[model samples]
Target: MDQAETKEWSRRYAGKRLLRSEILLDDPLFQQLINTSYFTPVPSIVRNYFQTQCQRCGNQKRSLFGSIPCYSCGNVHVYCRKCIDMGRVMTCTPLYEWTGPEMDWPHHSNACTWSGELTEPQRKGADCIVQAIQHREKELLVWAVCGAGKTEMLIPGITEALRHGQRICLATPRADVVQELLPRLQQAFAKLEIQALYGGSRDREATAQFIIATTHQMMRFKHAFDTVIIDEVDAFPYTNDPSLPFAARRAIKPEGTTIYLTATPRQQHQMQIASKKLPHVFVPLRFHGHPLPVPEYRMCYTMKKDLATYRPPKAFLKWYHRRKHPERQLLLFVPSIRLAEGLSEQLSDILHDCVIQAVHASDKGREQKVQQFRNREFDLLVTTTILERGVTFPAVDVAVLAANHTVFDEAALVQIAGRAGRSPNDPEGEVLFFHDGKTEAMGAAVRSIKRMNKRGGFR
Candidate 1:
């Protein structure tokens, strides 16, 4: 039980846990470390109808349960289906966690060299984080508007944390955002060991001081990060699943600070803010000192009916002609994949000279389509909400065909609108919502953007 024998391994994962099967070191040495009080084994699957839980994800739902014949224990076993993609977990599964000495700073890297300037509101948000770190706060929210440069607001605090040799991780909700953000973070944190972990990432072997990963990847780490910053916390899967937040907490030290960055927060967070349970800062302005693209509501009756009859919306076609001569990149957001394909083909018939391409989640050439659009190979991109976030096209004009549809919610609408006016050089662009009838979501999105603009002193 020599402390010196396991010191090196303990240093890398002081408060973290890993699956027993994931222990990568020599087997004899791992056993030695276990004997030396450097590791603890936690049950991966918890049992019972009322109390059955996944220790890794804190999922207690009966719907996530499935039974199998245990090979090791030779009995019926159950595991969580929610996180089954990560790995199967059963009653006999051993989730090894490091229960070792507190982290020691043998080396401190220089702060990130990112020389970007933050806007006044963004600076205030960044300052809130610096204060959070100093006070050792548990959680803080940076509730900024879309296109608010939320990532830039994290730079100061993340830089300071790195200078202090505190392990840091910034997790996003999706792989697209991770790919979109990786190169920028790499350039900003040039001197630091930054690792980007997504599906099939090549740089997973790097000894990371800063990690940019999707929420799914966060489950693989336990108590590993000292400062955990989760971006777009209100996005799809993270918003819908409780397991993700559990995974988020499990990925950081219990005492480590957590920050959630989002343009849209859940209703619970709104209530928490009102009750003063959550400390937060709101940045209502975009980084470029521009207002969010306010949506203009236009009635295009029988849009779905027109699509079904292989007819493009007369209103959209009329608007397209008026806006077409300028040759701006148009993103026509449709409600579903089927509509995108149908409407794109219908649109191609009317606008023969214009290249209109449709892209959706299951589209195998989704990336290629987006790239081609960026390269100006297409005049218009008819897409589903898949391109609503984590993508940018300079000076693009956006229109939501059938914006009243349930799929085009306020957050998605806001994000789709955000895609229009991102690049500073082209700060003013149109965001039109052409629908059969406007819904509460459409109305709310328009009002929210206007209110943000008014708050930002927009004329």
Candidate 2:
């Protein structure tokens, strides 16, 4: 191939491992590139004729593989069902990766444009991240409390990586986080181009050195990033889904750094830390230097019955009417979508002067509703656990209507309570848990909050 043609192909294929069908060229041109030793084809499903595993998602379960009659090859083919939503990975298909030279990323003398200074705790965490990248550490866990300026702490490490011309990706499990982070990152590094990708994202064509994407988007990458920062590492479905971690492992280079950012680390991670198997940094206080709001448990014995009858619980009503800060926005967390919608309507009836809305994962207008709430367009928001993490609403008092429900686990309850007291101006916001009965999860959540507060030097 000519120099000009090679450059054109290199620009498209560099740092990307794509299926042959995803390439925008004809078979003849693709063959020419392969023959020139620029592209390498890897089996999509490696098999021993009995056991099969998907190379993309790392699905090895025998139950997740199924056979389908093939049209191109005119034979029965086995496909991986686990990640079929991304694209089918069948036995006949092959993944293509560039075998050419690496792309030269641009380096800036001053990559971070944020003028704000980090607090002492945040600075300590930032140094840990920077050292991990500089030393090429395989993994580093950042265990910080909620509202601890975790995102700001990453600025220094990202800046250091950018100055070294290393590619960085900050991936999370939720799309809400990707949307929330895009503008912040853009303003932080105004000179560099950043690609924010999620499901149905419009910026799929651009490949930038800095990328903020959903963990699921990492499935499309292979050995592409030098530093992979997994934000909200403890939040679902990343912690619950095995494929997500697999994709994260596949996206980073063999010797790249992986950093995990979370307010609440899972049990396994805690054990690893105790055993001295995982290197970590801890930031126990929020950026505002205030104590976490410990949730107050209120018994509403008729909580389930009231929801069935579409009535607001009397206990919740009393607290709402007698709140210390009536002007503060309210986040009413429910366990299920039906309860969220029903409670929203019931509250709207009683609180005639207040604007109320309900949002869930499947809500098509969820993004708009959340933005409107942030604009103070609404006074109360009824939502499911989807908003339990990766969202920040300053000056909001939070309440979980069914804190005793099976859905309200210890980690989830802690994250929900964290919604309150995030803004320094309203650092004493209330967090109430109204339930029919107190459960072990609720007790554990309050204990966790108190432990973090004591660690933050709060009595």
TM-score of each: 0.94, 0.95
lDDT of 1 by residue, 55-172 (tens): 8778898888888898777999887887786667777777887787765643455667888888899999899998887677999998888788888888888877866778888899
- Collision pairs in model 1: none
lDDT of 2 by residue, 1-459 (tens): 687777767766776777877778898988988897788988898887677889888888999999999998899998999988777888888888889867777777688999999999999999999999999999999999989998899999999999888999999887778988999989999888999999899888547889999998898788889999999888888988888999999899999999999888888998999998999998998999888999999999888789897788999999999999999999999999988888888889899999999999899999899999999998999999999987888789999987999999999999998889888888878999999888999999999989989988989
Report each candidate's C-alpha RMSD, comma-separated, in the order given: 2.1, 1.8
Candidate 1 whole-model C-alpha lDDT, 0 to 1: 0.82
Candidate 2 TM-score, true structure as reference: 0.95
Count of backbone collisions in candidate 2: 0
